[model samples]
Target: MNQDERMFSIDVQSVNLAEYSSKGIVLDIGGGGEGIIGQLLGDKVVAIDPRSDELEEAAEGPLKIVMDARELKFLNKTFDEATSFFTLMYIEKQYHQKVFEEVYRVLKDDGEFTVWDVTIPPYPGGTKDIFLVPLEIELRGKKITTTYGVLWTKSGQDMNYYIQLGERVGFEVVKKEKNKQIYCIGFKKKTNAN
Candidate 1:
């Protein structure tokens, strides 16, 4: 399927963005892909992605950076909030811990972090999650099949993994929401001194 026809959205509307809009700066990881979150949040957000080209599509107001999420360049306690939308699934699992740590480091005391991503059920029987599902589309009058699935299955992780990792990195899960295909989690950075 063409880019226009390709579906790409992770539900983050569950989080109360208006609160962050007035509180302080919010970091948006991978927003460069489509800039959907930045488009909605506007100047309150600064979006980052390693792919510079993708950032060109981001909405006008937010600051867009071509940087990797695993090692953010910002100084400690720089942001009041951070968010990742269906971004971790595309990154290798080995880097997830680092990404979480980076987010924690950049967030101010009492800062919040939110992530919305696909979930991998422990038991696959009734799951709507797809694994290499094939779709046939006509391109130039020729039929072509594209097999699509969540990226890096060998390194993909689940909601439980994130919750545990965040705890280890000084974040506490304050809220969680699950749907047939995805999970939305909100974590607040602990205030205790490390």
Candidate 2:
């Protein structure tokens, strides 16, 4: 297969990420590139990404930080909310659990963690080395369209994968929505009383 044939784009409907107001600081993991969450939440978001260049590419709104998701630098119960908007697909499968643990640790009691990601199927044999999801994000009466591509490998992820990981890290699934191959999940950190 040639280079062109190595890339596969899925046919998915446009996913709308509506703008919402937040009461406190939101920790946006992998909040770089377009920085969708940062753009939506403005200064209330503390966006972090592992790569400096990625953070540099993000729009000016959130407080950008260069940090790893697996080991967050914030104190326990620091953030009121956290978000991962189409970011987890970039992380390797082995680090996902650690990322969840770190997110759970840094969030305050009853804090919410929302995630938006696509369902990626396992890599089929042959030269399909890239899987791409074209997203048309609708926010605050504007539209931003982009394509996120990741290397196609053996791992396959969906809503259930995240739900189980969140549960293992003491998060309760409060909401789940699916739009075509994309999904949104809202998870609340479980406090002792609940």
Q: How well does model 2 score by local distance difference test?
A: 0.91
lDDT of 1 by residue, 121-144 (tens): 442332233443233323332344
Which segments of model 2 are wrong by more than 4 Å? Answer: none
The C-alpha local distance difference test score for the whole of candidate 1 amounts to 0.71
Which candidate tops TM-score?
A: 2
Task: Name the best candidate (by lDDT).
Answer: 2
For residues 47-76, could you state the per-residue lDDT of candidate 2 as single tens digits? 999999999999999999999999999999
lDDT of each: 0.71, 0.91
Q: Once superposed on the true structure, which residue ranges of model 1 sit more than 4 Å away at CA? A: 1-22, 121-149
Q: What is the lDDT of residue 17 in candidate 1?
A: 34
Residue 16, model 1, lDDT: 27
